[model samples]
Target: MHLRRERSRKLIETFKASLTSFACEACGVDMEAIYGPLGAGYIEAHHRIPVAQLEPGQTTRLADLAAVCANCHRILHRNGLMSVEDLAAHLRARRGWPLAAEPRPEDWQGPDKG
Candidate 1:
């Protein structure tokens, strides 16, 4: 029974992970472009909020994640990142995509901070 429950938990996580890894939640770009960027794009899956910050017993939604290139993921999460929504919104606007109809919040200072 204990092992069964553990398997269930892992399966759930795997399903959620799969849902987010196929696309770049940040730019809506396909994972291929977000990852290796060429012959074989190899994107990585990122949890929007760090697992350490999650409330006890809480599981993050797959939509709250992103599939990004290794470098971008490192830049976005070198320290601790809250979420990439703001940066995503900015990129959206720059790309001329239909941006959020509401205002966007400021992104927290991340690894680039000195």
Candidate 2:
């Protein structure tokens, strides 16, 4: 079935709004964290089930999508059929570390000075 552009766009907006921070769901890489102000609010929505594999008349659910950074998105496309959990595990293994600790208030270097 052909997915409507408007529907896809709406899904992406909804997903972004639902997230606390616009970070890659898989590896937790925030665009703003890496690129500073330039990367604010940047993320790509990935269909959990590849659109190409959807059967005719099938419905798309919000749960069927995830917000990913460009790097993760590209890896997903290149590797094909890999789940978000798979990529997260690969990243953790590649880095030889578990998820990093959350930034402390004193450790923050953003422009907000109060």
Candidate 3:
């Protein structure tokens, strides 16, 4: 169990380090752009595949994560783990913006499917 925890921690660290910018993927809110130095690297990491949904022995990859702001993160969970793309579309629809092309179902599946 310790090894599992260590691996999870390292994976999350690597995922965060891989981010070039801390912009919310769903809302496009760049923390640094809004709060300047204070928010330079302040975006939250959200699991595209909720951690609880992972089957035993399933592994997560960087692509399974999404960079999001506090508001969008909360909203995502509040709406029952809605996909990042779905939330973005919902927001765009509310603003009457043209919806982005839908992703294929396969696009939603993360790697390491068992």
Top model number, lDDT? 3
RMSD of each: 9.9, 4.3, 11.5
- TM-score head-to-head 2 vs 3, winner: 2
Q: Put down candidate 1 lDDT per residue, 56-103, tens digits, no spaces.
A: 677666565566545556757764563567656766777565543221
How does each model score on TM-score? Answer: 0.48, 0.78, 0.76
Clashing pairs in 3: none
The C-alpha stretches of model 3 lying farther than 4 A from their native spots are 96-114
Global lDDT for candidate 3?
0.75
What is the Å distance of residue 73 in model 2 from its true position? 0.3
Per-model CA lDDT versus the true structure: 0.54, 0.74, 0.75
Q: Tens digits of per-residue lDDT for model 2 on 16-112? A: 7887767677777777775778999998989999766788767568899888888888898789668888887887677643552232333334576
**How much is 81 displaced in model 3, in angstroms?**
0.8
Candidate 3 local lDDT, residue 33: 55
TM-score of decoy 3: 0.76
Cα lDDT tens digits for candidate 3, 24-98: 777666665556689899978788987767899998788998888899999999988899999888876765444
* Global Cα lDDT for candidate 1: 0.54
Residue 42 error, candidate 1, Å: 3.7
